[model samples]
Target: MANWNLKSFDDIYSSIAESAYKDRPNSFPKLFNKNKSTEIDYSKSKKDNEGQITKGGGTDLPNGGKVYLQPDSKKLLEDEETGYNAYYVTDTETINANTHQTYFAIRGSDGFGINLPQIKKGNFKEFNYQDWINNDAAFALTDAIVPQAKYATKGMKEKITELEEKAAPNAKMDVTAHSLGTMVSVQGLAGLSESELNHVGKAVLFDGPDTTASLKKAGYSDEKLKLLDKKLFIMSILLIQLVCSIVINHGINN
Candidate 1:
């Protein structure tokens, strides 16, 4: 038979009992210095403590504690020349929440950051058959215009108009996008009038599919194709190197 130590159990119980006693209410009267003012003397006496009376419960003055003051709002405007305008327009779901679209008009200098503007209902009016070609429709009237694969809905053209209006009206603006965003950005920019194009500094596209055949057909240079092929070759080499490095690292870890 195995024997358990009774002495060990007694020690454990004693330690727990000591801990509980220490955590219990204070057993002695709190001490005070004669020279220092007591909180009781400073406070207004409310009720007499059993008649003969204690002066008061405590001082009305708060104990020294931390009070945090809010930091001042910094100015948003940046001071710079030759800077481009930028906008981070929220998608439609958010636009529906406030019953208006939030248009952020940002430029390199002054008047920077997000601005929420309520676009009235029916802001995007439907175009008549003539409006599609001759009127002030956002997109072109051409029958052969290819629908960009990235933009699945017709509502995208409305969004483009909103972005254009909300951007810095006087400053140069450039549209940029990643993946599906590139498709819409390019189409929107292409539809702009010649005057609007002058204000546009540059457009950046990332991982985007082919543009409409007409857009390319206007001018597809051999030099551009060679540059694209060179980039693809470099990318292939880098990908292979990355795979080899990953395999080597996995073997080392094992």
Candidate 2:
């Protein structure tokens, strides 16, 4: 396995997130060029986990790791009422021979690429853009436990619990999420128990709205919020540009 690096993992996680919207049978394999060492795990995959609506499967990384599309992935895609999707990937390298590292690549809002007018006209029953829009609105407007966040919390907890039971004692789990997924991830992480949170290593979120109100509404204490803050590493392209612009303007004024 290659040496562990955040940049390399970030690239892979981003690709996995984007793959949620793709409708191809070989989408996962194509990402890794279907290397000879690559293995597709189909024991739990249904119908090769391919379809226009619900797509899922597993692939072995070239570097001896494995990536599995959680079963909830298909449910999240097929059910408009729920807005959670994720892919779980094991790290190529472990901290020790007995310990392992895993990552959960949570997907953001989909349907952005769909034809809105056609969808509104009921041309695509399988792709519900309105559900995604409603999730976005829920993240922006209300603190009422967003269904998507609830789903995300449940999904993460289940995976973490399962891994804990099966993997080595010190196995570590990380999270990567984008856009609406960031909100989902934050609420989900906040929902974890102290012991579960301890197992979580890092959370890298991208371009998501602030979730303070939602977290507070969900009864996460300030102390717990502080703990979650310590683990989250948020990256926002727009925020970076704004900071750069402010710095440039300040220099000019001086």
- Best candidate per TM-score, number? 2
Q: Model 1 over residues 121-170: C-alpha lDDT tens digits?
A: 43332322221222112223332223331221222334344445553343
Tell me how candidate 1 scores on lDDT: 0.28
Model 2: lowest-lDDT 10 consecutive positions? 1-10
TM-score for candidate 2, please give it: 0.64
Query: Which residue pairs does candidate 1 place in steric collision?
Result: none
- TM-score of candidate 1 relative to the true fold: 0.25
lDDT for predicted candidate 2 compared with the true structure: 0.58
The residue-by-residue lDDT of candidate 2 on 75-140, one tens digit each, is 332334574556565643222344477677666666554777887897776564544656777667
Task: List TM-score per model, in order.
Answer: 0.25, 0.64
What is each predicted model's overall lDDT from 0 to 1?
0.28, 0.58
